[model samples]
Target: MKRKLVIGDIHGGFKALIQVLDRAKVSVDDQLIFLGDYVDGWSQSSDIIQFLIELSEKQNCIFIKGNHDAWCEDWLSLGGTPSVWLSNGGQKTIESYDNYSDEELERHLEFFQRMKNYYVDDQNRLFIHAGYSSMHGPEKEVYSSNYRWDRTLWETAVSMDKKLSKNSELYPKRLLLFKEIFIGHTPTIELGSKEPLNKANIWNLDTGAAYTGALSIMDIDTKEFWQSDPLPALYPDENGRNVW
Candidate 1:
């Protein structure tokens, strides 16, 4: 059967993304979901977005909007770089497109603007960038931005009891609402892990591809995984984002 594959934060590690996907031997027939943070690290933010745009035409692809992506989109649209965003790896993204033409940059901006904040599949699996603070699902407008900027969702999951039956009323409403949840904002490294982590049915696939570890890709069904070399090895010449 064609597999459902989910990719973690890429953070401008274009070469790493290519490597892991190649290693996984991902075919166009397979369903691919990129959890976001495709830019703002390493030195290929523009290249990464371009690659995914072309890749989408060749395969089944779903893109999520990440906090970094949001900031980048705002910068691209406003034409002003904010210090806060720059400190959080936005400078690397701006540098990546230093030579791009107006049309090319426009395409990337469009791609960023069109990214999904969250997606719910037929299986009720939720795919988001950073996740939200609400336990009532993604419907509430108050916490909507949290879909791409929140970490409390994962933190709550990490603190919950995964052993609890899904049907149990005590189960976290967030997890209870979906068959599974996949996110990428908070790197696994933050959880003291260098690989993908599963807690309370929430899967954090980001393996610190922007800094400390490799890019990761996992089969959503079998839970099998593949990774690229450490991102530094892939972009040895460039100093990617150093901050969280």
Candidate 2:
């Protein structure tokens, strides 16, 4: 069977993205599910999106939206970029397109606009950039914009035992609807873990590629994973996460 490979946030660390993919040995047969945050932070945000655009053409790919991606899309489609977004690394995304054509930039914005907030496969595996309310499936109109912005879903899962209760009703409410859930945005490094974390059947794949940890990718079925080196190390003399 073709493998299901889920990737964490890229955060504009294009070199780190390449490293993780190379380590994962991704092939055309595998389905690559990106957990979003493709831009912002570090630099080369445009380069990363272009690379992904080509990669999607070569392989099965699904791109979910992250909160940072929403900010980028809003600025691109409209005029005023939010001050908070710029302070949180949106400026680098702007800088990355210094040499790009208007058409190319438009394409990037369209990609962002078309991205999904959540993905539920035939297996009922849920992939999202952040959290979900769990009150309904991904189709609910109420969750259209909140799925990628909510953090409570993951927090609820983390609060439960890593080994959840056997009782059907005991699972974290947000995760009960899916066979398993994969998410990014909440970096594992911030949780004091340098590795992908599994709790309440939800996996947090982001290993803080923009900092001292690596970008992570995992096989959903086999649970096998790969990582790139600390992204800061990938770009010596440049402050990777200090785009702030």
Candidate 3:
């Protein structure tokens, strides 16, 4: 059978990412989908991007863009921030690319810009960086910015009636076409909480590995979920911080 695996927010933790992929034993034949946020949080955004590029070249992988990535690109356009990024694990990302030239940085940025916002398959499984916006009416368009940055819309959509919620002003009525939607944003308290409040059909995969959370992945067909051991502590520099 063809196996499809969806990985949650990476947050630049290449080490944890490798570990999880190894554990999952990702094969060239398997379909691997990254739920975005590959950069930021862990300090290896550059390395992570390079690794992802290599994966795209070698395996069946699809990349989605996350809010953090959008923020990082925007931040770079405004002016690269060593202090801000480093403070929130950007240091690791910088450290990963210390040897790269200006050309390499530009290439990485370009790759990030090209990422798609969502991936929908015939199995009724939908993958997006963040949840869909449920605030607008049926005719309202879903924008990329909403996919990456908006949380209120996600909350509202998941909490509202499934049928009615799909009619959200922020999301297109076409989205109701799917049977199930899988997403990775708002980190859950634990790997897989049973409570509806802690868990939604949305399937949040970010276990908060960079902040007392675990790196996670889920198999679409079997609904099997896996998580890496949590970090000993929040990266010391990322205390009470949010960016990256």
Candidate 4:
């Protein structure tokens, strides 16, 4: 049976990414929807992007751009390295690219350029790297960066009163725009959960692979998930975006 798998933030943990995909028995028949942040943490940021480019050729993929990805793209194309980004893992991403040739970097840049801000499927499910503030949905968002940086959507869902029905006037308008929303960027570890979190039809898949938590992947339909070993264990010699 074909599965639609949604992946969380990678943060350059390519080994973990590979482990979970194998553990899940992912195949060409599966549709992989990546909730970005593919770079900026562990040692293989550049390699992860390269692998994704190759993987997309053999399987269906939808890559949603994340804030980290956006920053990386800017550095790659404009040659401006933001200190904030560097402090947050961009430095490691830069180090990871030291061995790549200019031509290869260009290819990787193109890959980043092609990533989507958000994707809405035929079933009305939304796959985005982060949340959007628009009550009308992501398409009508005035500040496009919110698509890759907003946390209010997740915050609203998780903090809503459980007794409130969707039909209630007090219900959040943004939640009504989609059947379901899948996002990455805010790690679930912050909420004290090491697994995928579902609140008010929003699924947060980021389990903090960039720090100490494990990387995760989930079947949107089955809600079944697979996770890699904690990233620190996978790369004990390195600290992956642990500071901020």
Best candidate (score: lDDT): 4
The list of candidate 3 runs beyond 4 A from truth reads: 75-88, 134-143, 157-175, 190-200, 233-244
The TM-score-based order of candidates, best leading, equals 4, 1, 2, 3
**Clash count for each candidate, listed in order shown:** 0, 0, 10, 0
**What is candidate 1's lDDT per residue for 91-164, written digit by digit as tens?**
88888888989998889899988899888888899999888766678876386678888888888888886587
- TM-score, candidate 4, is 0.99
lDDT assessment of candidate 2: 0.84
- Candidate 2, which segments miss by more than 4 Å at Cα? 141-143, 162-170, 242-244
Off-target runs (Cα >4 Å) in candidate 4 are: none
Better of 1 and 4 by lDDT: 4
Q: What is the lDDT of candidate 1?
A: 0.87
Per-residue error (Å), model 3, residue 70: 1.4
Residue 42 CA error for candidate 1 (Å)? 0.5
lDDT over C-alpha atoms for residue 145 of model 3? 69
Using TM-score, give the best candidate's number: 4
Candidate 1, residue 13: CA error in Å? 0.2
What is model 4's C-alpha RMSD? 0.8
Off by over 4 Å in 1: 162-169
Residue 8 accuracy (lDDT) in model 4: 99
Per-residue alpha-carbon lDDT of candidate 2 for residues 1-244, written as tens digits (9 for 90 to 100): 6889999988888998888788988879999999999888888888998998888889889999999889888878885588998878888888888998989889988888888888989998989988866466556637566677887877887787756674757765556678998999888877799899997778999888766778899999999999988888887766766521
TM-score of every candidate = 0.95, 0.93, 0.77, 0.99
- Number of the candidate with higher lDDT, 2 or 3: 2
